[model samples]
Target: MTELRDAALASKAWPFEEARRVLKRYAKAAPEKGYVLFETGYGPSGLPHIGTFGEVARTTMVRRAFELISDIPTKLICFSDDMDGLRKVPGNVPNQEQMKEDLNLPLTKVRDPFGTHDSFGAHNNARLNAFLDSYGFEYEFASATEYYKSGKFDEALLKALHEFDKIMEIMLPTLGKERQETYSPFLPVSPKTGHVLQVPTLERNLEKGTIVYEEPDGERVEVPVTGGNVKLQWKPDWGMRWAALGVDYEMFGKDLIPSAELSSKICRVLGTQPPELFNYELFLDEEGQKISKSKGNGLSMEEWLTYAAPESLSYFMYQKPKTAKRLYFDVIPKAVDEYHQQLRAYPGQDLKAQLNNPVFHIHGGDVPASDMVVPFSMLLNLASASSAEDKATMWGFIGKYAPDATPETHPGMDAAARYAVRYFNDFVKPEKVYRAPDVQELAALEDLVAALKSPEAALEQIAKKNAVMGNDEPLPEADYGDEDFLQSIVFAVGKNHGFEPLRDWFKAIYEVCLGASQGPRFGGFIALYGVDETIALIEKALAGELG
Candidate 1:
C-alpha cells in the first residue's frame, strides 16, 4: 500500500493508478508479455469528434502513467473499425448521394465520399491521423479493413470461425427474434459485389474454413473465413481484438456497458479473460443531452480551439473521466482557467498533490512554472467591461495590472488577451448584466477596495509574497498575495459584514465592478490589476457609469 499511496505522489495520475491496479491483476493472470498494452477504438462512421479526442487523450494519459511506474515498455494501439458496413449516409460529408448508393458496403471498399482518399475509410482514417498528429499523440493506428485484407487478423478470424456456434449462442439470445433468426457470428463481404452481407449462414465447414451465405439476388456464395472474406460481428470482434492484441486495458463509453459485458463473455468463451475495462460516462451538452455526431449536438474541435488552448481541452477530459460532465463552449473558460491555476500552483504543491492535479497530467507531468499576472477569466471580464473589440485594446488593462507585461514577456497573458477578445465578442458582450451593490455590500466592498488600494494585497502578495495564514492574521510578509492570503482576507471581510453565502459578496463585487456575475478570483484580480485601477473601476460602477 505504501507504493500505491506514494505512487500518486510521484507525478503519476488517477488513470495511471487505475492502470496499475489492472496491470497487477493482469500480471498475476498472464505474464506472457513483459509490456502492458493499452487499446482505444475509433469508429470512422463520421469525422473525428471531441469525444474521439477525449478517448485518445484519456488513454494516452494512462499510457503515460504506465511509463512512469514501470521500466517495462508499453504501446497504445488506436484501432479503427473501418471495415464496418455503412448503414446510412452521414450528413456532414459532401457526397451524400454517393454514400447512400453504396450502403451496406464495407467502409474501406466504398469510394471516398469526400474525394480525399482511395476510400471513405481511408479518408476518415487520414482525418483521424491528422487530428491526432496535431496533438503530437504517440500512437500506432491499426486499420481493421487493411488488417483483415492483409490477413493480420486471420488467426483471430479462424478462432471465431471454429467457435461459430458458441459465438452465436452467446449473441443471438440477446437480440430481437427477427435479428436472431437472421444473425450469424460472421458477416462475409461478397468477393464479387464487395457488399458486406448479413444473411444467415447456410452451412459452416471448420476444415475448409469457409461459410456459405446467399446474396439478396439469390446467388449462393462460399467464402473462406480468412483473408478479408469475413468479419466477426461487432461484439465478437471486440473480444477477439482483446485476446489477439493481448490488450490489457480498454476504455470505452458508458453506453456500451451491455456490449462490454457481452464482449467480455465472448472473450472468456474464447479462452481468455477480458481486458481491464474503464468505462467513462458520456459527455453531454449544456442541456445535458448526450453528445452525438449523428444528432449534431456538442462542441466541435474547431470551436474549442477557437477560444481556448489545446491544453484547456486536454485538462477538461482529465477531470473525473468516469463522471459525466458537460462539454459545451460555456464550460471552456472555466476549464482553461482551471488548467492555468493548476499549472501555476503545481510548483507549490507536494508531489502527491501535484500528481493528483489534472493539469499535472494534462501537461505530461511537466507544468509551465510561471503564473499569469492576470487569469484568462479576469482578462475576459476586463475586455468585456472596457468594450475592447480586440487584443490590442485589452493590452492596457493587462499592462496596468502587470507593469512588465507585453505579448512576448507574458505569453500567457498575451494569448489569453487575444482569446478574451474573441470570446468576449462571441459569448460575453450581449450577456452583460451589471447590478449595483446594496448599502451593506457597498460598505464592505469599499473597505476591501481600500485595502486593495494599499498596494499590500492579494495581487502584490501573489507577485512576491509567501506565508501560511489563519483567521484575521496580518498580511504575509512576502510580496505576493497567493491563494491562501486571498482566501483569508475574503473570509475575514465577509465574516465581519455577516455576509451569508459569502458568494454574494464576490458576486456583488463582480457584478458591480466587472459588469459580470463571474470574473477571476477577486483576490488575484485585485493584485494583478493593482489597487488604483480596481478602485477607479469600482468607484465608476458606484457612480452608475458602468451600469
Candidate 2:
C-alpha cells in the first residue's frame, strides 16, 4: 500500500493531480470539520442529466485517488439547491399546465409533475440520487430546502448578512446597472404567496438578522434571513455553501469558471478559503453546440445507460476531462469498447502504470477483470449481420468463437451483447445505407470472397508469393479458427487487387454487405459470424440481394 501511495503521489493522471491539490489544502493542518469535504452541487431545476452524473463521477475519482495517498477521512456531499424558485417549467416533464402556476415558488414547494414525490425538487432529487446510487457512489445527499429550514445554514446566513456590503461590492460591478439597483444577495420568501421574492430590499437590519422587502402588492414585509425565509443569490450561495460546509474540493464545468471565481472571492469574505476547484470543459452535442439542459440537446444519463454500462460513461468522463467531448449516442460504442480495452490491459500493468490507468480510479482501485471475450464493436457488427434482437442470438456466435465463455461466467459480455443489439436496432438500423460496391471495390470483394472460400490454399500461395518477393515472415498458422490468418488473407486480397488506402476494402465490404460505411474488423466479424456465412453475405451483395 505504501508503494502504491508513492506511485499515486507521482502519478500524472488528472484524478491524482486534483487529489494532490486537495491534500495540499491541509499541508499546515487538518480541516476543523474533522474530514475533508468534497462536494458536487446540483440545481435540481431540471431533471438530472449526463453532465450531472459526470460531476459526481469525476469528483469520486478524485476522492478515490485521495484515499490512496492520505489517511485523512473524506466525505463526499452531493448537494442539491432545491430551495431555489422554479423560474420556468421544464418542457420535458408531464403536467405542464399545473407547473406554470407554480413559477417563482421554491422547487420544494412546486407540484411534482411526475406525481411520484412530494414536490418537483424532491422528485428531481430522487432521480439524482437514483442516478448516483445506480453507479454505487458513496455520498451524503444535502438538500438546500433541508439545510436552510433545519437551521444548518443559519450561521452562514448570518455571516453573509454581516458581510453583505462586501459581497455586494464583489457582485455589483458584474451586473448591469438596472439589475445592480435591485439585486440583493438575499431572496426573501413571501409569507402570504409562498413565493421566493427577488424584489429589492427596502431595509437591512443586521442586529435583527432580517431584511425588509416590499411585495408586488405594496405590502412591506420583514423576514429573517435565517431559517428558510431567504436564500442567497447563486454566486453568494455557492460561496456560502463552501464556507458553511468547510468543503475542501469541488469541480464544475468550464462555463462556470467566472461564477466559481466570483464565488471563491465571496467565500474569502465569508472568512473561509475556497475549495480546490477543477473546472472541466463542457460537453457538446453532435452538431458541436454546447449541450443545454433546457434545450434537451445531448444524451441523458438514462439514455446512455439504456445502451451501455454505467462504467463506460465513467470511462468517458475519466479521459481528457479538460477537453470538451461530444456526448451523444454515437460515442457510446467507442466508449464501451475502449473501456473494456483498458480493463483488458489492467492486470498486466505495473503499480505505477496501474495508478495512472483509468479503471483504477473508476472502480476505486478495486477494478474488475473484464469478461468481454468479444469486443463491443464486433457484437454490434454481429447484431447487424444476424439482425439480432437478443443476447441469446449473439451468444450463439459468442459460444462458437470462445467455447468456454457463457452468460453465467461472463456477465459483462452478456450485458454488452444485449446493449449492442438494442443500440443497433435504435441507431444503426435507421442510418444503414447499403450501396453496391464500385468497380475496384467489386473486384476486391470478389478476391476476398475467393480467398476466404479456400483460405488454406490461398494463404499458402500468398506465403510463397511473399517469399519470392523476399518478405519471408511466415503467414500466421492457416487454421480456419485463426482470426489473424483470416485477417492476413483479407489484407493480401485487398493489397493484391490494388485497393488504395486498404480501408476502402473494408469500407466497401461494410457498405455492400452490412449496409454501413465502417464496421468491426472484417476477419474478426467473419470468424465470429462464420466464414461460410460471410461468403453467402458477399454473394448476396454481388447479386444485389443485400442492397
Candidate 3:
C-alpha cells in the first residue's frame, strides 16, 4: 500500500500527472477487458516524418509513467488510418506520376509506386513499422483497411448506420457550404474503381444497411455497410473507431481539436462516451511555421536516427508536451545534452526525483546501474572540430582523459562517438559560425592556454591571486567532468582580470575554441576534446591564426 502511494507521489511530473489522471478516469468506467489502453495515430499518406516518431515516442513515455504510478496493465495501439482516400501525390515519394493517377482512390486501393508493398498505404505502413520496431517500441499495430475489410468494424458500422441522422446533424455545422451540400456520414467505395466517392448519397436503406450513390460514370449502385463496401466519413469514422476498439485514451495534435470534438459528439450519439484525449500543440520549423505532412516542412525520422540517439529524441518528447516545440535539427543538440545531464545527475537524486527524471522513464524505469557516456553536445562539438569519420576520432582524445575507456568495455562511448560524427557533418558543417576576439578577450585566451598547459602551477598562481575562491576545492584537483569546474574557472578568471561577469570570458573562450559564441560547458568540452587540443585553440586565438 505504501509503495503504491509513493509511486503515485513520484508521478508529480507533468507527463505522469496526465497519465495518472487518464488511467484513473478510465478505471472508474472500465472497458469490458480488464486492461486499460493508450493510443496514437498515423496517416500513411507519405513517408513517416518526425511528427510520427514524436507521437509514438511521447505516448510511450506516458505509458512508462502510467506503469510506475498504477498496476493497470496498459496497451498502446499504433493505428494507421489507411482507409482515407489518396487526395494528392506527395512530392517526396517516388513515382509521383503513378500516385497522381491513383489519387481519389482509397490509399489501400492505390498503387504502391515504390513496388515495395501491395498498396501505397501498405508501403508507408511498412516504413512506419520499420522505425518503430528498430526503436523498440511496444505497440500493437492496426490498419483501418484490414479492420474494415475483415468485418472487425461491422457491428460499430451498424450502430453508426442506425444513428446516421444524428451523426449528420453533428457534422453539418462544421462543413463549408459546398461540402455541406454533398456531405454524408457514409462514403461509398465504388466497386468499379475502388475509389471512395465524394458524390451525394442518392438513397439510404436503413433496414438493409446499404447506401446508394451515383458513380461518376453515371451509373447508380447500392453497397452494403459491411464487406468494406462503405467507409464512414472521417468525422464519424473517428467516433466509430473509438467505440469499436474500446479505446481508453489517445493523443493527437491540437489542430484536430474541432474534428475530435465532433467525434466526441458522434460517439455520444452512438451510445458510448469518447476516449480521454490529449491534444499536443503542433511542431514548428525554426521559423515557427507549423509542420504538415503535406507541406513536408519537418525533418524525417530516418534523418534524426542517422545523426542522433532515440533516447535524445525521446527526452525531447518528455518535456512540455502540451506546449508547442520547435523541432528542427538545431533543437537536437540541446535535447542530447539534457538527456546526458539527466542520466549523469540521476544516481545522486532521491527516489521521487529519479522518478521525475526523464532518463528514468526513457529507460522505462529499470535504469542501467551506470550511464557514464560523454555529454552529447560536447561530443558534437568535439566531432565538429575533428575530421574523424568514426569512433577512432573520439578515442584518441578520450584515451588521454580517461585511460580506462576502450571499445571492449564502454559501448556507450562508441555509440555516442558515431552519433556525434554524423551530427557534425549533417548540421554543423554548412552553418558553422565564427567571431574574432578583441584585446581583452585575447589576454583571457592566453591565460586559459597558460592554465591548461601547466595545471598545478596555474592553480597555485590562481590561489595566490584569489585566495578566497580556492580553499575548499582547489582548481588543479577538481573533477574536470563537473560543470562547476568550468564555471569556477570562468568565475575566477573574470574576478582576477576585471571581466565583471563570467559569461564574457566564457563567450571569449567559445569564440576562440568552437568558432561560435555559445557551446557546451567549457570544462566538459575540454574533458571530451582533450586538454592539449583545447589549449591549441587558445594558442591559435593568441597568434591571431583563427582570423
Candidate 4:
C-alpha cells in the first residue's frame, strides 16, 4: 500500500494527475461532511449516450485514483436535472406528438413516450441508471425533481433568494440585451398550468422566501422559491447544486468551459467554492463534426458494444481525453487490439509502470491478465479467410492455435472472437477488394507456396548443413507451426524476388490472398491457421480463385 501510494503521488496518468489536484483541495483538512463528493450531472432530456458514459467513466477513473492516494472517504453522485422544463421533444423517441403537448412542463411531468415509467424524465432516468449499472459504476443517483420537491434543496433555494441580485449581476452581462431585461435566476412552475415560467421578477420578498412574477394571462402570482414551485435557471441552478451538494470534483465537456466559469462565480456568490473542473474535448463524427445527442451522427454506445467489448469503449475514452477524437466504427478494431496490448503488457511492467498502465486505472488497480492468445486483428482476418458466420466457426481455427482455450477458460478471447466475426461480416467483408498479384508479387507468392509445401524437406537440408559444419545447435528444429521460421521464409521469398520496401510484399499478399490491403503478421497467421491451409490459400490466389 505504501509503495502504491508513493507511485500514485508521482504517476503521470491523467486520472492520477486529476486526482492529485483534488487531493490538494483537502490538504489542510478533510471536509466537515466526512467524505469528499464527486459529481457528474446529466440533463435527462435525452437517452444516455456515449458522452454520458464517458463523463462518468472518466470521473470514476479519477475517483479510483483519489482512493489510492487519500485515506479520506469519497462519494460519487450521478445527478440528473430532471426538473428542467421539456423545451422540445427528442426526435429519437416514440410518441413525439403526444410529448409536444407537455412542453414547458418539467421533464418529470412530461408523459413517458414508451409508457413504461411515470414520466419522460423517469423513463430516461431509469435508462441512465441501467446504463451505469451495466458498467458497474459506483454512484448514487440524484434527481432534481426529488431534491426540489422533497425540500432537500430548500436551504440552497432560500440562499439563492437572498442572493438573487448578486446572482443576477453575474448572469446579466452574459445574455443579450433583450434576454437580459427579462432574465431572472428563478423559473417558477405555474401552480395552475404546471408550466415552468421564465419571466422577469416583478418583486422579491426575502422575508417570506417568495418571488412575484406575472403569468402570460397578465395575472401576478407570488410563489415560495423553496419548494417545487420554482427551479433556478440552468446556470444558477448549476452553482446552487454544487453549493447544495458540496461537490469536490466535477468534469464537463470543453464546450461548457464558459458555462463552468460563470457557474463558478455564481457558486462563490452562494458562499461555496465550485468543484475542481476538468474540461475534456468533445468527440467528433467520421466527418469531423462535433458529436451531439440530437444530431446522432457518431457511434452509439450500443453500436460500440455490438462490435467490441465495453472495456474497449472505456479504453477509447481513456486515451488522450483532452484531444478531440473521431468516434466511429473504423476506430473500434484498433481500440480493441490496443486495450488487449495494454493488458498483455501490464503484468510484465514494474510498480510505477503498472500505475501508469491504462488497465491499472481501468480496473481500479486489479488489472486482469489478457487471455487473448490471438490478437483481435488476427481474429478478424481469420474470420475473413474462413468466411466465419459465427464465433464457433472462428473457434475452429482458434482451437487449433490454442488447444487449451475455451469459452469458459478464456472468456475475453471468446468475446473477442464473437466481436471479430460480427465486425468482419459487417465492416470488413463489404469493403474487401481483392486484386490479382502483379508479376513480381506472383513469383514471390509462388515461392512462399513452394516453401510451405516442402518445409520439412528444406529443414532436412538445413540439418545436413549444420551437421557438416559440426554446429551443436542443430538448426533449432522448427516445424510448420513455427511462426518466426515461416515468417523468415516469406521475407526471404519477397527479397529473393526483388520486392522493395517489403511492406509492398505484405500488401500484395493481403490484397491478393486475403482481399484486404493490410493484415496481422503473416507468420502468426500461418501458425494459427496452419501451414497446409495457408499453402492452399496461396494456391487459390495464384490460380485467381480467391477474388
Candidate 3 lDDT for residue 82: 96
Q: Please count the clashing residue pairs in each candidate, in the order shown.
A: 12, 0, 0, 0
Task: Estimate TM-scores for all models.
Answer: 0.86, 0.97, 0.91, 0.96
Per-residue lDDT tens digits for candidate 1, residues 1-547, read: 3564456535445776776866576554445776778888998888888888889999888887766666567888889999999988888788778888899999987789778799999999999999999998999999998888898888877888888888888998899999999999889998777888888999988998999999888888899988988888899999988877778888899999999999988887777878888899998989999988777788887899889888889988889887899888788888888888788778888767777878767777767765467767777777765778888878876676567878888787778778888998888877787787899988877766655555454334333222222334344543334544555455556656667887878887878877677766776665655546667887888888886
Per-candidate Cα RMSD to the true structure, in Å, reads: 5.1, 1.6, 3.0, 2.7
Indicate whether candidate 3 or candidate 4 has the larger lDDT.
4
Q: List, residue by residue over 247-287, the lDDT tens digit for candidate 3.
A: 77888889999999999888888888788888898888878
Q: Candidate 1: deviation at residue 91, Å?
A: 1.4
Steric clash pairs (candidate 3): none
lDDT of every model, 2 decimals:
0.79, 0.90, 0.78, 0.90
Candidate whose TM-score is highest: 2
Worst lDDT 10-window in candidate 2:
460-469
Please provide, for model 2 over 75-116, each residue's C-alpha lDDT reduced to its tens digit, 9 standing for 90 to 100: 999999999999988888899999999999999999999999
TM-score of 1: 0.86
Alpha-carbon runs more than 4 Å astray in model 2:
464-469, 474-477
